[model samples]
Target: MNSTAVSVDRNRTLKMIAREFYHGLTSLLFPAICIVCDQRIDEPNTVVCHNCWSDLKVLSTDIVKMKQIPEQLDTILPVFEFNDTIQKIIHGLKYSGYKSSGVHLGRLMAAQLPQDFLLKDTVLMPVPLHPLKKRERGYNQSMYIARGIAEISGNIIRDNVLNRVKNTVTQTHLDAHERHANMQNAFAVNRSCDLSGIYSIVLIDDVFTTGATMNAAATVLKSRGVASIRGLTVAAPI
Candidate 1:
């Protein structure tokens, strides 16, 4: 090889070595543990250990009914039952800032979709957090999950297409009726975006509780001329 080409190759190799060494030091200082089982994770960018991941209980392939789902939502698909393991994984991602957790869960969520779930022109939209809440959390867990789904499914993630106009109270302690009330009119579509070619949308969220939030998001999209809207979530109450 020419001198210049040889120099470039040497630089590339040195850079790769430095990057791996940095990652190795980081891992040693802050070991990655399985979100579910608390076992040490040797593989990079993995949330759950191999055993816990395999032990995760996937809901049956059949579509399950969601209580209080909005009429605007054509379907709601949840990958796992809201069991202890799933709960911890979600809590880590949503509250603990373990962002890598979303990648595994999101891929599982995408894998659970039906063979024809996403149409050719389907867009993935994550449920938006109110600006203040987003600021407090430092990140939107749903958006990260949607990104993971996009990574696996090759679907476009249109996060800006929807906006949460209302800063509602947390729904964690709310009853079914209270949740519906709190989420009413919480979302609206961004009028500036040209969604002309999008045939369908898969609304993404971290969890499906009373379905109030997902339904409210779907309502906004329907009002903005979206025809078909579906919901995808990591876990739901069984």
Candidate 2:
């Protein structure tokens, strides 16, 4: 073996050892715990333990298709059922400052999609959050989800093109009709964005309730000549 190649191998091994040592030290000082169960998490890069992750109900493709997809969207893909487990995880992500949960769920969501679901020319677009609400939250949760999906799907995210024009109230207690009304005219596309070359878009969000939010965002993109559009969410109500 050449001396140069041997030296490169030694450097790579040294770097890997350094990383492992750092992770071990960090884990010892600050133990990771599951978001849902509050149990210690031994996994290197996850907040939820394997058992809690297994408890999440996976949605069948047929069931997802049966759900109410907004007319503006061609279809919607949801990963998990919106049961008690999901509610807790989402609550943490939205209210408890656990933004990493979004990314964790997003990767799982994207991994289940068909290979062609996200094309080379397609981009990920997060449902826009109002500037005021975004300031309060300190970050947009959907952006993290999109980032995670992009990591798995190899697609670019186009969050800059969509803006939430309305500071709509929370849809938590609202009926389906009320949600629809609240999201009307809630989104507007930026006129300066060059979307002509974009072939498709997949909207990412944390949850799917009545499809009201996704529909409102899609309406604006459709007006701008975006022909192919769909929605992806971590979970949806049964």
Candidate 3:
């Protein structure tokens, strides 16, 4: 009934219409194609087709539970195996800047998760990227993944709570011990963050390798009074 409320509604409607028009125009001019299969896809937001998506192997609950959990984390939830189609997808998301793909992968993970996997009031947080790495990458790939999970699960996201203070060398080539050492003192709780009523958090990432990154981040979160901390990723090695 108020003029301000009506104006806000009008603006929201205009934005939806504009978004639809842009999608329609882009789809018409350059139809979306599946990256894995190279088949034309109607969905503009995703680069991989449904068939290719299904090609990713789901990790059994036993494997997920048995995976080496960092001492600082309460649990680890890995949805898919880090091989084949998923490997290609993560490669594109991390190396080629296909952030939408990361989001899609997170959506897939949330959809496939068991009914009682995530605890109530569990906030989702992406592992922080160092300032230098973030500048070079333009965006944090795990943030988009967390965004997708939030979209599907209706969970809150807290991106500013954890901060990456150390810009260590990439762990891709590092052995297990090397990775553990590389991530030491890499993260710290944000100085202004008050962990008052927040009890649980799930750190999101694209893959679970040695879990060195999650371990480092969780150590910082636990030290800051977060009661429950867990790790969730799209894929993990068998």
Lowest lDDT sum, 10 consecutive residues, model 1, at: 61-70
So what's the TM-score on candidate 3? 0.84
List, residue by residue over 19-98, the lDDT tens digit for candidate 3.
99998898889987877778898655778888888798899988887898888999888889888788888888988889
- Local accuracy of candidate 2 as per-residue lDDT tens digits, 1-238: 9999999999999999999999889888989988788889987677778888788888888888799778999999888999887888888888888888888878887878888888888889988799999999998999988988889888899889999999999898999899999999999889899889876999999888788999999998999899989998999877
Every model's TM-score: 0.85, 0.85, 0.84
lDDT of 2: 0.88
Error of 1 at 1 (Å): 14
Error of 2 at 1 (Å): 30
Q: In model 1, where do residues sit more than 4 Å from their true spots?
A: 1-31, 61-63, 66-68
Task: Say what the RMSD of model 1 is.
Answer: 3.4
Local distance difference test, each candidate: 0.84, 0.88, 0.89
Which predicted model would earn the best lDDT? 3
Ranking by TM-score: 2, 1, 3
